[model samples]
Target: MVVLSKQTTEQYAYIRHCNKTSAFSSTGIIPVVDLSKPEAKTLIVKACEEFGFFKVINHGVPMEAISKLESEAINFFSLPNNQKEKAGPPNPFGYGNKKIGENGDVGWVEYLLLKNNQDYNSMRLSVFGQTTDKFRNVLNDYICAVRKMGCEILELMAEGLNIEEKNVFSKLLMDKESDSLFRLNHYPPCPEMALDNKNGENLVGFGEHTDPQIISLLRSNNTSGLQICLKDRSWVSVPPDYNSFFINVGDSLQVMTNGRFRSVRHRVLANGFDSRLSMIYFGGPPLSEKIAPLPCLMKENEESLYKEFTWFEYKKSAYASRLADNRLGHFEIFSAS
Candidate 1:
C-alpha cells in the first residue's frame, strides 16, 4: 500500500473519475494481427478502421529480451523512494514519480521516461552508469528493437492506405533525427482505494487521455488495469497479454488520416492487490515536420478537418494544458464554405 502525499491527495480529490463498468467484459473486440503472416496488412487496416487499436504477435522481438527489460525496470523502480528521487524530477526525459500537472490532476504512477537517443541525458547513464551498465544496455537494446518494429508497422499502414512506401508520413518518422519518447510505467497496488473511496468511484492509476504521437506501442506485464474508451464513450477494460504488444493510433495519425483513424482515449485503474508495469514507446515525426490531413486521403472538394502544426509546437502546448483536455481541438480549422 503506497501512501499518497498530502498535495497529491488533494489533487486526486479534484479529478473527475470515469464511470466504472468492470461488469463490462474485460476483453473488448481488439483485433489481433500476426505480423509474420501474409494477411497482416489487411487485418491491420480492418483493426484501425474499427478500433484504432490492436494486438500484435510475432513482431520479431525476442521474448527473453523483453523479459530482461521488464526485470530491469522492476529492479530500478523497486528502489527506495528517496533513492529514485535522486534521479531528478520529471522533464522531457528521466524518472518521475506521481507527477502532477498544472490542472491539479496527479498521475498515480512512477516512470522512467527516455528519449531514443544515445547522446541525450539519461538517469541510467548519469546516476548509475558504472553499476547499472547492464540496465542501460538492455533498455537501449529494447528501444532500438521496438523502434524498428514501429517503422515496420508504419510501412504496413502506408500500404493499407495505398500510399507510396516513401511518402512523407513514413519518411519523416524514419529520418535519422526523428524524435520518440519511451515511458516505462509502474503502477503499484493502491490497497487504500478499497477503504478510501467516498463516492464509490474507481481509483485512477492514470487519468483518461489520448496519446499525441503518430503511433504508440505498448507491452505490459500480466496485470489487468488498462481500459479503452469506445466511440460510444463507454469504457472497456483491456486484458493483459505477456507475449503481445498493443498498437494504437495517436492524435497525429488521426490528423494525418483526416480522422479516418482515431486516437483512442484510454486509462489505467488501480486495484487493491497486485502491482502493474507497462513499457510504452511513443512514435512521432521530426520536430520540424508539419502534420496535417494527407491530400491523397481527401476528396478534391473536401475540406481539411485539421490545420497543419509542427510536432515541437504541439508538444510544448500539450504539456501546458490539462492531461485530459482535447489538445487536438487547438489545431482544428473550421470553414463555412
Candidate 2:
C-alpha cells in the first residue's frame, strides 16, 4: 500500500485579487453535443467557432474504465510523497507538486504526467511499477479507447471545415509516432477557499491559460471548479457532468483555421471542501510536423497570421515560459498593406 506524505494535507491556495473583478456570468453555457447523433459534426463546428470548447455526451468510453482509473488514481496520489517523487526530478513527466511561486503566483494542484509514445513498456515500468500491473493495464486500455474517440472527433472537425484532405489531421495526430501526454491532475480541497468566497475573492486551483496542443480531452470528477473565459471576457463555471467529457480547442487548431476557431482561455477554481481529480489527454502532432495556417482557410489576398513552426520547437518554447505567457506571439506574422 502507498503511504501518505506529510505535505499532502498542506493547502496551497493562491488568489489573484485583480482578476476578482472579472465578471462571472452564471447564464453562459457551453454547447453540449451528443457525439453519437447524426448532427454531431455541425454542432461540433459551431461550438468550436463560437466557444472553442464544448461538452461531449455518449463518448463511448466504458464507464467501468473511468471508475477503475479514478479509483487507482486516488490510490496513486495517496502513495507517500517519496514514492511519488520517484516519478520525477524534472517537469516533462511524473509527479509535480505545487510550487510556491516563480513570480508570486502558484497553482493549487499536483499531477502525474506520462508520455503516450511507443515506449510504453519502459514508461509503464517507470511510472506504475510492477506492483500496480492491473492499474497499468487499465490505463493502457483507457488510452486506446480515448485515442480512438479523438480520431473520430478529428474526422468530424475536418469534414466541418470542408477540407479536401479530410484525413490530414487524423493521419498526423493518430499515428503511432505522434506525441501525446496523459496528465492525472489532483486538486486537493482547500477549505480556506470559503474565506475567499465570503470576501469576494476567488481561489484558483489552476491559473488561467490556453493549451498549446491540437486537442485536449478532460474527464473530471463530479466537483465543480472548471471555468472557461468567453469572448466577452466573462468567466462561466462549467458544471460537473460525470457522464461527459470536456473538449477544448488548442492553439494549433486556432492557427490551422486561420483564427476562425479560437483557443479558449480557462482555469479551475479551488473547492471549499471537496477535492477534485481530472484526467487530461492531450492529442498533438509528431514533433517533426510543422504547423501553419491551412491554405484553404485563408482568402486569396489574406496574409498568413502565423509563421510555420515545428511542434518540437513550439513545445520547447511553451515549456520555457510561464503558463499564462503568450507563447503564440513569438510566431505571429505581420502584414504590410
User: Superposing all C-alpha atoms, what RMSD in Å does each candidate have to the true structure?
Assistant: 2.7, 3.3
Cα error, candidate 2, residue 197 (Å)? 6.5
> Compared with the true structure, what per-residue lDDT tens digits does model 2 show for residues 113-146?
7888435424543656765577777788888888
Q: Candidate 1 lDDT (Cα, whole model)?
A: 0.78
Badly placed stretches (over 4 Å) of model 1 are 1-28, 121-125, 166-168, 195-200
- Number of colliding residue pairs in model 1: 0
Top candidate (lDDT): 1
lDDT of each: 0.78, 0.78
Candidate 2: how large is its RMSD?
3.3
Segments of candidate 2 deviating more than 4 angstroms: 1-28, 100-105, 118-129, 194-197
Worst 10 residues of 2 by lDDT: 1-10
